[model samples]
Target: MASDTDFYSILGVSRDAGKDEIQRAYRKLAREYHPDVNKDPAAEERFKQISEAYDVLRDPKQRERYDAFGPDFRRVPPDMDPADYARARAGAERRTSSRGDPWGGGTGTWEEWPEGVRFSSGSAEGIDLDDLLGGIFGGRGRRGGPIPGSDQEVEIELSVEDAYHGGSRSLTVEGAGGTRTLNVKIPPGVVNGQRIRLGGQGAQGLGGGAAGDLYLIVRIADHPRYRLDGRDIHVDLPLAAWEGALGASVEITTPGGPATVKVPKGTSTGRQLRLRGRGLPNPKGRPGDLYADVKLMVPHRLTREEERLFEELAGTSKFDPRRRR
Candidate 1:
């Protein structure tokens, strides 16, 4: 049967996607749309759609039934046939008397049949007793039980240094219970795309169901002086042309503090000075190394004396940078 509510689209998976693909899609979307994590007005509705899709697609039997009956699978029997429904409909119409009374409220069909008599409608719109009882007893109804709370995911922006060192921070969210503040302890070495889960911080549950969790996705802000690659740290070390020709020692800022590094003679732009174990620390491995890349610069505007010195060097120096030796 054709379906309007496509589970594949809800979870962002292809129609022929495998089980793992569907699960991964759900997890990724769950982190973004979970009510506690995302405070946007539409997040809750989006989360519900994905959750409902996941609930059915994750189950083998439910998935098969859903594939066959669309969203109405839950309300219709899996093994029911079209001919069976036709027969049931015909039987209900046959049970209806010429009179219009349903339960013999008037001096109608039931009275003529004596006591303990019941009647059905006389057409396709007639009510089938089995269907009515099944709906009332939750045999194949859409809504039948308690529902768990929705999970939430939100972004928490942090500085590059803050991610390296870790610290305490605060966050405020407009939850189902209203605006609330939470104090968060950031773990050391936390990196971009990492998530911090806070349990019981999601949407309120229904019918005594358990509340969901909240996830904080880390987004590290850019830095003017530093660039990070995994556990590695990189910084530009500016130098004059003369410094590149005749080595010198210079002080540079690192995450730990200021430190002096020797600039080897003949250093060129893009040359890196490695400082072992000075980058971000990791719990599972050794700390990353820091690299100071050379950045050669010249005076924006030369002074008279500096211009004279440069003219003299141009006349006397034997170096021919563009010529092949």
Candidate 2:
């Protein structure tokens, strides 16, 4: 709040800018000024400025406060009345020096910010400054003493086969105190990016507050033979040229197990053969279907007899791939 530099000016956006506009400005500035991408020594400082600006503007409540009273918006609690904020601002002004701020942390008063280091958290835009402030001033400002610990998020990766069948797995969740292990039951037919909630498994709360929940974000690992889309599964079914042209019973492998799919005569590449109820099963609803995608394979090195037979077929058959039928 005490700084002469305006955050809106730093992000190159207007004071009345919308959230999307603010975010766009932040992204453009961040990419241009990021130290990893930009070699200019000043770029690091500019990047921090944009990041700090975005962190405030992105949060609705925070943006409201920032709009009302520049950086010192943080000096006054969100729930405090405008009259109380003025009084607190006066009190903070009297308590701190010209160099100090009441809204900041680390070697500064509550209305100020430390140089060079805005936020170091590795989250979406780095640390949540509001959460950090809440944690800091919770004892004085909050009525309930301390809120429940923040929910923790962790990604759990599963193989295609494991995801198809579903099983039990163990994982380590990082907490404020340290790391703890938990047993997770991967529900059958859980889709990618789906979250599984674990109750009361987050960080320990302060002042006897209730612990928070843990969320496991499901991430399915890439499989060599299988491609999944929602409840449907696609597997490439390799067939010889003759089998594709003349039809044959071909044995193909599915995520569950190996099965046989009959290739109809005149089957073409990219042909999909649906096998009902052969994909992942959903406990809550209907099971998924599996589709075998045909992939025709021609012999790379043919014997003399095979070449002669192909030559004879070429002379006898009237098949034109390029001609429209």
Candidate 3:
């Protein structure tokens, strides 16, 4: 049957999508639109829709019923023909509209039947058809069951050095309840957008339900000297003109510690010197490489002796830098 509130469309998944694909889509959207992370007023309502869609589509039985009966699957019988039900419901709606009560509050109709009355033809023993049909036509009241606490998302920024080495740090969070202090342990080699889950750290649940989890979204702060691409590190290597002409070993600073790189002879500007396994440390997988970009530097002011030496070389030397190769 056609449905207005399509759970598959809400989660951005096809009707034939697997459970893992559905879960991945839900997690990605949940991280983006969770109320604690996104401040847009409409995001909260969108989040509710996403959560509701995920909740219903995750269960096999509910998904089957929803696929067959649409949004009112909970109230419709398993064996009922959806097309006939739809036509009957539309007729009831038109009849109610003709009675001048557009909202189905008119008297003397099955839509507004008295309590405990069996409106159906067959015997539905001990079942209140009035309440059942009333709920189907959008006449249900608020539920009084225990509600689980809401899952929350927060950003945690880290320096490149801090991200290289795992450590413990204090985090202060401010929400509707008040300000709270927490000690968070950052894992090593955490890349951007990685989430660290802390169980039972979100808002408290109502009616004795379990509290939700708190997810820390990792954000790596920009560095003055280092640039990160995946686990690889990039840094500028400034060298004197002589150092570029003649090979020299120079010390460079890395997130791990100080390291030395060999500048090859005849090296020019823009040359990248790779130092293997010197980038970010990965505990579980292969580590990354470090790349140093070569830049030739000249002294701002030349000494009188340096000027005389340059003049002599210019006068006698056959080498011409501007000559075409």
TM-score of every candidate: 0.55, 0.58, 0.58
lDDT tens digits, residue span 1-325, model 2: 2134677898888988998898889768766875545779887566655665776677888778877766556443345465544544454445346424434544422332221113342223434444434433322223335545655668899988888888899998776698888888888887654557787787766555567667786778878988876667889888899999999987778877888898899998999999998888888778889999998999999999999999999999999989997
Q: Once model 1 is optimally superposed onto the true structure by TM-score, how far is the C-alpha of residue 43 displaced, in angstroms?
A: 21
lDDT of 3 by residue, 264-306 (tens): 9988899999999998888878888999999999789999998
TM-score of 1: 0.55
* Alpha-carbon lDDT of model 1: 0.70
Cα lDDT of model 1 by residue, 1-325, tens digit:
1134788888878867788988899889977976656879988677667766876788888787777555555544435553443444444344444444344334332221211223343443444443433332232222333334666767799887898889999998777788878898898887655657787787766545456677787777779998876567889999999998899999999877888879999898989999899888787679888899999999999999999999999999998888986
* 1 against 2, candidate with superior TM-score: 2
The best candidate by lDDT is 3
Q: Who is ahead in lDDT, 2 or 3?
A: 3
Candidate with more favorable, higher lDDT: 1 or 3? 3
Regions of model 2 farther than 4 Å from truth: 1-146
- Residue runs of model 1 more than 4 Å from their true location after superposition: 1-147, 303-305
Candidate 3 — which residues are off by over 4 angstroms?
1-145, 312-325
Q: What is the full ranking by TM-score, best candidate first?
A: 3, 2, 1
Sliding window of 10 residues with minimal summed lDDT for model 2: 108-117
- Reference-based lDDT, residue 244, model 2: 92
Per-model lDDT:
0.70, 0.69, 0.73
